[model samples]
Target: MNNNQNIAETAISCSGISKNYKKVEAVKDVSFEVSRGEIFGLIGPDGAGKTSLFRILTTLILADNGTATVNGFDVVKDYKKIRECVGYMPGRFSLYQDLTVEENLEFFATVFNTTIEENYELIKDIYVQIEPFKTRRAGKLSGGMKQKLALSCALIHKPTVLFLDEPTTGVDPVSRKEFWGMLKNLKKQGITILVSTPYMDEASLCDRIGLIQNGEFLKIDTPDNIISQFAENLWAAKSENMHTLLGDLRANEHIKSSFAFGDSIHITIAENYEVEKLIEELKQKGHKKISIKPIKPGIEDCFMELSQSA
Candidate 1:
């Protein structure tokens, strides 16, 4: 990856990236690439080492092994260069909580040796939303507003690539949706984004995603591709006694996998199931309101299956 690399080429690349914390392996030989200007997602649950990997890539910390490059600059030798070319939002809100929103934004801008006015266009859409409360202390902002202010500050210097670590972990549903929308808009402006999120649903919004688990990548592909590769027929199973139903479904000889999903259970059948016969069997076992129907696999389903296999 070099300056000549276009929007479609790789803007970020990591080869055998790994990090360890005493006894625990935080990242293990994780490798991937993010094309320039693409909204590439690193999807996994918390404590899966997402933050560790993000720290290494964003130059906040060094990996014990392997190499990575952001904007064609090495993570080690070109750390300073990488810092100047990328913007990072950590999992935690790290802004000056006591400072006014405007002050925080200005502080970040000055640290980068740039003025807010110099890159105002890059952050205008996001910043304008929070500008009305610019004089307010950042600690007093609502979750959504705080999220917006953080994003505005991240973009204050207009870096070529952005790294967001679990950006939507604790926000409200609407705010999460709004934040992702902002990322979509940023993509149109040709800024490559590497966003990590523990939310499975958000995985579909990325141009491509790398599914990680326990410090290792289980799979990497477009969401649709990952779902298409799901191994078995899936069914949504529900009954009055949903808890017991899960155990019963898992005990069934023909069932390959069974797990609770929301109010219903997602089941992967080992072979063709006779729906009517299965219902009759459950009824004989005293299950009422029993309903089972074939269901399409989503990112969560794919993740569950991969995790089990891994």
Candidate 2:
């Protein structure tokens, strides 16, 4: 295929999409596209409009303005076609909790006018992990098992596009890793995926990501490209009195910004700032075992910078 053909084969497209509820603007003129078989991520925190966007694209809710399409079908004009071709796993567990895992999967397959056996290979990897508990009620299963079951149900229909809203939230770290692995396998099947998550670490796993906040997209690009846009000197600082280090670092005039990250404080310093001077100042303020080192910015750091500017 030529360049134009590749560009024209988009699986998802949104143009100036906007939505509001009562007095709150849930989504604000968001626009983007996902190429065929690409993994596009909506990276943001709770109430940042990720869920709203997913709902709009999934045809569950109408956007107040703008337009969107999935699998080349209009979200509003061809809602039926979009529904038939897309698989959506909502942020919450919306599956049949009262039914057994196998029963729930069978029900969804029947609803979609298909059967589990018809697409068994599509969900085999995920389903096999939870197959031992196929007779167990979905509600009684562990967090990880429930996640896998939900994924299996979503894939049973062989959708061209998949929308997963925080599919790994509340699951163990191992489960999250495994779920992403399942997604990778699905990508190999030529399925386009649009997943949303608040976890910054997961951003790097996608082909591209949109950093969203306050109902707006701060930036959208590949993870590495976004990190490249962080035009500031970042440093990690830690002291014996870790709790008080953030305030002290922020109080310094040379420090542009300071935020606590795990055991250390990540700060952006002025061009003329000297690390030795800051360390000495902290030591004078009764902080001991001070440590400071320059570091590369990650997705979280990039998000912070973009959100602040937005």
Candidate 3:
């Protein structure tokens, strides 16, 4: 592929990117691209090295090997220029706790040599929510309010690319939904976004996602495509004795994997296995109130399968 194709067609491109801390490798030779005006998510559980990868792309840290470019600027050579063109909201809240909401916004704007009014339109929708308590200290703000304020500060610079590392991690369900809504509006303004979260349900909101685990990318594709690639037949089974059902399923030779999801146990059966046969086998094994049926695989299901295979 042409270098310019990555520059002109995508907002970020990384090739053979790897990072290590002492003997442990935080990120393996990873490579992926985020197209302009698209929301690309990094989906994985904790300790997946999502934060390490974000630090490299945002110029906070250098990779041990390989190269990456953000907005056509080299992460190492063009560090200064790249810093000016990208917005990063880290996984942890890093704003000044002593500073009020208004003060925090002003500080970030000043760092980029801009003013809040200059980019007010970019963050109007999000900022307005916390504007009522602009005089309150950031440390006193609610988790949801802090999230909104951090996002507003990141956007005050009018960056071409935004990197949000688990921005919704500790927030409530309603706040999480609202935060995603704000992201969609930002996408409409032609800003490319790369977001990471452990919540599997959020995977479908992005245009595409990369499933990472233990510093390795297992799969990268649209949510639908990833779910479609689930190889073995899957069944959702639940019995009166839920705990016993899990133990028995794990011991069964025909079952590939079984894990609890909500009230149902999602089971990936051995290839070519029939659901009816599995149910009969469970009943014979002294499982009562057993209900089993074929069900579609989800992003979490795919992640579980990939992690086990890896």
Candidate 4:
């Protein structure tokens, strides 16, 4: 491993972390670390144990096996200290619905034994966007505004580490972009952030990402590194008949895997197969006006490869 790959003084650390409910395991032997001041993302689809791991790290729930720590404080024994040093914004908006935005902020600050003015600078940038609606009830704000408010409240305590559980899940595209910008600003202020999201596009925004599925972490690395590790030659093929193109590609013996992307089907061809041979085969399958070219592997592509191999 390179120097950069070596784990630094981690803001959060977990080893052999496992959790379960009844007969099902929510997280299985998951282990990874987030370096200080870095934005580490947990990328996976729903029911992939992202929230379960978040709950354990935030001290909201206990892990059934292994151990974890935040800022060198054990999550179980030092729950209070860990809670004080980290801000957790759950996937759902859990702020008081009846309280105004300002009121909600004040309440959270008070709970931390601090005042809004004391931590005002920490959240000033985000708060400014929602300041105009300070008097609006939390329940009345739009999805974007509510997200900002929730984030502001979480930062009111000036936590050293921030845990955002799918913070942009339901927000609009513009708001999702805005929220990531806010996280970048927070990173500049030296706050280590651990955010979970199902969006593969957002994976590139993080310094490093842990791709989790079926309650286990499959791989962890920088987005570019992960994409480079995709060993197969990938191609994006499109035809006039999109549906038939997918079925035809799948039926081809030379094709390893084929899945529909936005405007094309991302395909991995078998080893030792020339592009010309594959094109000829597709053409014989009645895929006229076909376009096939090798394309760069994206985060989603890497993710699909990992899941398929697993």
Residues 75-100 of candidate 4: C-alpha lDDT, one tens digit per residue: 99999988887999999998999999
Q: What is candidate 2's lDDT per residue for 1-310, written digit by digit as tens? A: 2422432378999999999999999999989999998999999999999999999999999999999988788999999988888899998998899999999999999999999999998998889889999999999998888888888888888888999999988777787887898899999888899999888999999999999998999999999999988999899999998888888887789999999998888999888869998989999999999999999999999998988877
Looking at model 1, residue 81 earns an lDDT score of 84
Distance from true location, Cα of 45 in model 3, Å: 1.9
**Candidate 2 clash figure, as a count:** 0
Give the per-residue Cα lDDT of candidate 4 at 272: 79
Residue lDDT tens for model 3, 1-310:
2423444566899999999999999999999999888899999988899999999999999999999999878899999988998999999998999999999999999999999999999999999999999999999999999999999999999988999999999777888999999999999888899999999999999999999999989999999999999987888999988998999999989888889989999988776777888888889989899999789998999998888888
Q: How accurate is candidate 4 locally (lDDT)?
A: 0.92
- Candidate 1 has its poorest 10 consecutive residues by lDDT at 1-10
Q: After best superposition, candidate 4 residue 75: deviation in angstroms?
A: 0.5
Which residue pairs overlap in candidate 3's backbone? Answer: none
lDDT per model, in order? Answer: 0.90, 0.91, 0.92, 0.92
Model 1 segments beyond 4 Å from truth?
1-8
Compose the digit string of candidate 1's lDDT tens values, residues 97-124. 9999999999999999999999999899
User: What's the C-alpha lDDT at position 101 in model 3?
Assistant: 100
